[model samples]
Target: MHVTAADGWRLPAGPVRRWTLRPAAVGEPVVLSVNQRNHLAGVVAGQPSVWLAADLPAGSVPGIEAPTDLLDGLLARHAALRTAVAPGDGTGAVLHAPDGLVWVEDDVVRAGTSSDATSAVRDLLDRACHPLAPGPPVAAALVGAGAAARFVLAGDHLVLDAWSVALLASELGTPRALPAAPAFPALAARWAAEPALPPDDARLHAWLAFLDGLDQALPTFPLDLGTAPGERFPQRTLVVPFLDAATVAALDDLGRPEGASAYAAVLLALGRAVRAQRDEPAATALPLLVPVGTRRTEEERATVGWCTTTVPLVVAATDDLRATGERLRAALALGSVPLDQVLGSLPRPLRRTRADVFMVSWIDYRRLPTVPAGTNHVSNVTEADDVQLWLSRTDAGVAVRARIPDHPPAVAVVTALLERWVAEVALLLR
Candidate 1:
């Protein structure tokens, strides 16, 4: 395979060399993700590229090869999956950084039952999904054996985000070239070199000042779901789906009066649910953190990283749901705030407090490729949970993903909470 840079820049063409990061210390609580506003979006800073290793039971699935050809196709199809910087992309080299490419690493492990296979897969995913690490960006990985054989892909957030995970799943097992997408290095150079990017505005400056006062990085914030210690990582997810087209139209109509969006309504509902789960005063304002995609330009959409900002809605217990929804609307209106600056403004202590940061994030990815005609896709499992909530938009309508800190009571939990939240929000709007 060969690559010719569109802009006439010559790139290295050679066989790949690999290295391993030996464990230096024990009990290192990996920073799996950063606050929405932080530069590291759900990844650790400085380490460009994350390694996603999937442990599969030793067996042969139809149409799959041991050293998969699909893997090669994926890398060749997406340049971001193959290239890496020699020194890394950070500070000065940020402009030339690639979206970090993707590579597959393989290892074999002892056989286990279906349950073990599933658990092992989840464990590797959680362990490898570190908060956005800085670079030399390379979304490649080294795979190896553990409880089972694993395949890992390490890449930087500078080129991708969480939603891309679904895409990874889609590409895996069945690698094929996608229509040409934007290149990461080009976008990075443009962003870094552009003179017109608005300087830190007044609001941005004030927020930064606030963050300067509190730089105390504290213990990792645990999502308290009130589960037995062992149950902390419940192999359950709340699955939710969107409302019908008619219902979605109704929501758009209702939103016209106060400029509320289907997203705002979802936030209001999630805030209410979180309040109901806790003993806090109803009047206490619960801030719902909504993630706004900053990939606004045609070219920007294709590039990734922590390009999302948090829009906070302070929901009052006494406020009617509509009123809360309006507040969300107003907050979303002022969506130009830079997320990095916002995180920088938070007193380091408060910023790291999981308890203080309980909120909701809105994700919309309907415009990208759709799930293939007959693929099995799952939705949110429940309507409510204890703490953090996620509302995502799809061509169908709105969906949800809520994270509860053991305070709320429920049974038979699963992974489609966001889907259900989207359904009801559309219902209320309509």
Candidate 2:
């Protein structure tokens, strides 16, 4: 399976050199579940952050060698990686096995030069980040030469989530013979057949009423960008290393005494920062969309796909951090309902505007099993129109990454917002 780029760089042919992966059974087309449908809808609606990527350290890359073994093993074991979505009679999507499972390419300019590694990897990643066609969604490649070489994997978010990345990272070197978990198609079938549980009426009513009070629009961070119609917004990211290892531990200790998790504390601090920066009325409610994982059991965690939903977390402008934390926890607990169900319950107009709200996501990277020694995991960024505040718990403590619209005003304002967010986090921990 030696694949050579047009420029003559050879890719380490994977183990499946002679045969394509054939589905065991392929009679009826698998219907896309409600969750899968929502994901597709997001893509159709122009949400740009639809890819996940990871970079793993490579040992001495002896000119011709690549991580073909690792990539081959992963595709062979993970059925979800081989799945694809195709239109089904204009009704919905039908899931099926793609003709190919993985796409590999080579980017090393020459055999021994490391200077082109970073740019080459970036170019590979950018190409892999685009939306998947009606074929395999995963892409991989080896970049750089010798000691500086690294392997990178990129997949469509529709089929691979952050958990899948972590799972693959854990199993990279040591292939474990774990029990076979339900594949994505099986899970989708089960989810589609499951009866919808009634949402909490009281909570739903309160949420709708809250939105009504806001005139069905949430306040965005003040920016001075000129009003233009249909201009494509560029994306900018601001990374802030605001917490050290000791500070993270202390913050955890401070929150633990109050029955608050680190995430809740961070949310509270973000709420406070928003209030301070916007100088909103004390009664103003800032709506935040937080992603809650749908994988509840161990088996579900082992399964791959976009297993998450964004739920509204409305934070009131107040001084009571404890109360805010309690509210956030409760909201997250009640956010287990599928996103389609949530949108279905809302009015048509509100449903259209729901995704316009800001987003806050926290990833505790420490929970991921350590990869092989010398192999560091690099995070990938997805471009989105909404103001997104991502908090990562890394070895250095808490790292804040803000993804914002690339308009001049939005960039400037978001930079200040993140600065204020760091200060608020410091104040809370102190």
Query: Against the true structure, whose lDDT is highest?
Result: 2
Compared with the true structure, what per-residue lDDT tens digits does model 2 show for residues 1-430? Answer: 0111112222222221111222333423566666556666777666654556555544522222536555665665666676655544222434444334434444234423333444454455455544445454566656544454455566767677766766665565454565555677677777667766556665555555545665655434333333242344655566667677787787788878787777777777777777776644363456666777777776777776667766667776564666777878767765655545544666644523324346787778776545554443344444435576667776768777666666677777777777886788788866
Q: Which stretches of candidate 1 lie over 4 Å from their true place?
A: 1-73, 76-113, 119-159, 166-180, 185-237, 240-249, 272-284, 304-306, 316-326, 333-335, 343-351, 373-386, 395-398, 406-430
Which digits, one per residue and each the tens of the lDDT, describe model 1 over residues 192-266? Answer: 353332454665553344334334322221223445432333223333454555665676677667666665555
Residue 108 in candidate 2, Cα distance off native in Å: 6.6
| TM-score of every model versus the real structure | 0.56, 0.80
Scored by lDDT, model 2 comes in at: 0.58
Candidate 1 yields a Cα-based lDDT of 0.40
Off by over 4 Å in 2: 1-28, 33-35, 42-49, 60-66, 87-134, 199-210, 213-231, 279-284, 351-356, 372-384
lDDT of residue 62 for candidate 1: 22
